[model samples]
Target: MERSLAIGPGCRAAAAAAIGLTWLTVAPAAQPRAASPFRLHGTVEPIRSQLVTVPRLTGTGFGPLIIIHLAKPGTLVKAGESLVEGCRAAAAAAIGLTWLTVAPAAQPRAASPFRLHGTVEPIRSQLVTVPRLTGTGFGPLIIIHLAKPGTLVKAGESLVEFDRAAQIKTAHDREAEYRDFIAQISKRRADQIVARGRDETELVEAENAVKTAELDLLDKDLVAPIVAEKNTLILEEARAKVAQLRKTFDLKRRTEAAEVRILEIQRDRALNAWKHSEGNADKMRIASPLAGLVVLKTIWKQGSFGEVQEGEEVRPGMPILEVVDPSAMRVRARVNQADVTRVRVGQPVRVTLDSFPSRQFTGRLEQLSPIGSPSGLSNKVRTFIAVFSIDGSDPHVLPDLAAAVDVDVK
Candidate 1:
């Protein structure tokens, strides 16, 4: 209070500085307190199934150590190999790779109302006939060689040959006759030539005798008148003789020429006969007119069914074989009268061969028989024939093969 104080601006500044230093030292020395720890208090609870029972594992050999290896759906498996392992009961139940085999799905069924059984046949076929042998007098010619059934032949190919023994003999005989006629004609011509020359010489001698008698008449003029009359009579007789000789020679020449003409006619006839016999021999061979497969025709004789074989005798104009075009084939099926109405021409059809079940063919109904006939054992069961034209060709598609035909309705 009573003290005297001399305070300057520096002294006031030093005192404030000393007060700030003292507060800084005291603040750091006093640290803040730590936070309190949290407390957690709870208990374990039991699990409960709602609206369903949760069963516990009770089977034998099935517990926490249970293990199983399941096979995939498309896994390759061998016989006696494990397919499902783990549960012995399950493994034994499904053993030996028990695969439920199922056949492949069937093809789509066509909208066909009915089917019929039938045989395969050719659409175009020709009958082979035995050639006619004329003027040879040979009947039922013997067959030397015959073509086997199922032989493919072309047009104009030789198919049959008849026995030529008889024909050969006939041809040789006719030829000899022709040669003999030619020789006779030649001989006749030579004789006629010689006979004409002799007639000319005889005519000249008769003319010379007449001339000599007339000269004797000239001598009679030098002698008595009675001698002249006798000479004239002798000349008349000689002239008459010459005239008779010339007439006789003309008549002989005409007769000889007529005879020669007759020989020429006979020769011509013989030549014609020879040519005819040779032609008959050539006609013994029969040729095909179309290209196709050969089918032997069935011949019924004496209650036996057979075909023309080699060494067999066949009559002229008889059917020996049939040539069928294998390219165009058809199915001839007999349908019941009740089902005949369902089939129509131009309808699509499905054909299957009994020999080859895997193969299938498509065709169209080409024709339907107008008349119905008996088909079954009883005459009351009548059937109508139906023809189907095949669309394509196959080697296995031959005539008479049993086939099944399915026709599509409408």
Candidate 2:
């Protein structure tokens, strides 16, 4: 019986070991825990990968993140909601004066909601070309004279003034001679003057001289349509010259029977001369061709006609100033080629810009490229673009939002 008990204990232990081994094998299969999900730490953006940029310092993380519109950080902001605060002092001031223009259509058109998923752009191929002013006879400035570098100008403002000092001196000398001739004639008796006929040529020239002085008064007021502020200083000296001429001279010619031909000839010559001078003076008025946010450009080295400063001689057709309207805002984005097939035109999408991280604005797929193109943020394989229209009402959409577009293939 004792032997039997010992064998039973051995049998029990072996059974227990076998049970333990079986339990261990089944536990792994029967009981499982889930793998944790990935948490993406980014501000709520109009796009998935990129940030919607605002003038507000943010998710760019160049320095520290500057939060704008703290109250609605992750909430829906209204159309006029002050989404950001504490911007650069100049930027804030410009908002009132800054204006944006919708691209004028070839046909007069009604307003339509446009699908805009383009880079914040300035030249849209249709903006009116900047005016170029060139002059002849004033003979291309013997010495270069330029307008002020950074002066704010009003509409019909003057930009630069040619040194008319030499012209003034010549006019003054002519006037003195004319006055002397008139004095000489006044001293002579009328019959003696007529018989001599020597002073007739002098008297005619002096009359013409007075007429030229009157023309000078008109030529002096050089004015341009104020294209924008900071075009240059107004042609103050030129206007003053016109004022001086008007204050000093009076010449009236009567159309008598014999002298009519001579008067007509003089009038024709003066009219032609005035036309040329007026056109030349118009060049001095550099006005903003369009209203927009003015950002001074400094990339002149790259074959670009950058911002022109006062005291710089600019030809007509040179871009002296720039105005980018804030209202012309468009959101731009990059998407992957691997996922390119899934994208199509008119796809609905959403965007969250880095500037207003918490804001989510809905968009529609506006454009898809016919051909594949290469992109930096895209995979090496050729990728296609998928543009979506964003809510234009949001002023936060000013520009440069590193936006990602989620195209809903479904």
Candidate 3:
């Protein structure tokens, strides 16, 4: 039979305290142990296998085994492959922990890799640009004669000679005109002097006639009254004639001076034109700045683009040749943006000639462009230009030769 038992509050509290003590004593033993906080994630690289290390054990029942296993040549290893293994007791005594590293084994490469392709160029060069003949009033000139391509020239030598026929004719014509104007100016000066002298003489004569008429009016006091009045009118007429002559003389002098000035200006213009034409005609000859090998520049010709020839007619201020110093040589290379950061100025470099594969040259990285530019037609790819100055010169190491540059960079 089920029976209900009623207990007092003090008795119930004593029973609950007893149950709490039992749980507190057992909870500590029931929790799980914590996992390690440190873990490493990486791949196992196949390396030259080697022996493992073990320390001497004290009071141990078993001795550690030291095994040496070297992987075979061309061996490939996967991740998690055991490189070394040791007993926990031995590892802790030897290294406080257990890990060892070995470099990879070497294998035969199928082919040699290429670092970069570049072009050979001269280190020092002078571009024989078109002279500023146009600024000297000889614009739009045509090239009559030019030095042949690949011609070796010396300083002060004529590299290019322009056609000066038109300029020469203009100069001669202007000179002739200038001379004519000079002669006309001289004649005008003499004629002006003669006209001025004649005006002065007429002015003097009119003044003297007025004085004589005044004297006659004074004498008219002894003659009839009508005669005196007539004398006074005569004097007035003389004075009016003198005033008219003076005005006409001034007008004539001004006109003569203006004509002389006009003649002088024409002469000056003609003389300046003649001098400008002469100077331009002389500037038609372009001289070389230094002694070097001359290379012709390609220009737009009659219908197509080709090298500038002697017979080709070229305008003034057109570059027709480049003088390159072959002794000083260099290589221009374009390094991809991915590899540009690996290259630095003043670093040593090795260069190989494409034509002469056996020939290798040593040079220093002299220049590196800080800015990057798009390569070819692809805007997505960019490259930096690097210039290397060749250490020494070789006869076969000419400009425009294909080459390869090897840089030491990881």
The TM-score leader among the candidates is: 3
Instruction: Tell me the TM-score of each prediction against the true structure.
Output: 0.56, 0.35, 0.64
The sequence of per-residue lDDT tens digits that candidate 2 reaches over residues 8-46 is: 323455675654422222234565668888878867643
lDDT measured at residue 50 in model 2 versus the true structure, 0 to 100: 23
Is candidate 1 or 2 superior in TM-score?
A: 1
Better of 2 and 3 by TM-score: 3
Off by over 4 Å in 1: 1-124, 154-158, 218-230, 287-290, 330-361, 364-388, 399-410
Sort all candidates by lDDT, best to worst. Answer: 1, 3, 2
* Candidate 2 stretches greater than 4 Å from native: 1-118, 122-130, 135-277, 286-292, 301-316, 334-337, 373-386
lDDT of each: 0.79, 0.45, 0.77
lDDT of residue 190 for candidate 3: 90
- Residues 1-410, model 1: lDDT tens digits: 35344434445456756544222222455565688888999896535311212223344543322235555543444444444434334443433222222223334455556788899999899888887766746788899988889999999988888998787788898899889988998998999899899989988988998999888887775899988998889889889989998899989989998998898898888888788888888988878879999999889755799888999888888899999999999999888876787888899989999999998999999999999999768687789888998899999999889999988786
Scored against the true structure, residue 86 in model 2 reaches a CA lDDT of 42
Compute the lDDT of residue 79 as modeled in candidate 2. Answer: 36
Q: TM-score of model 1 relative to the true fold?
A: 0.56
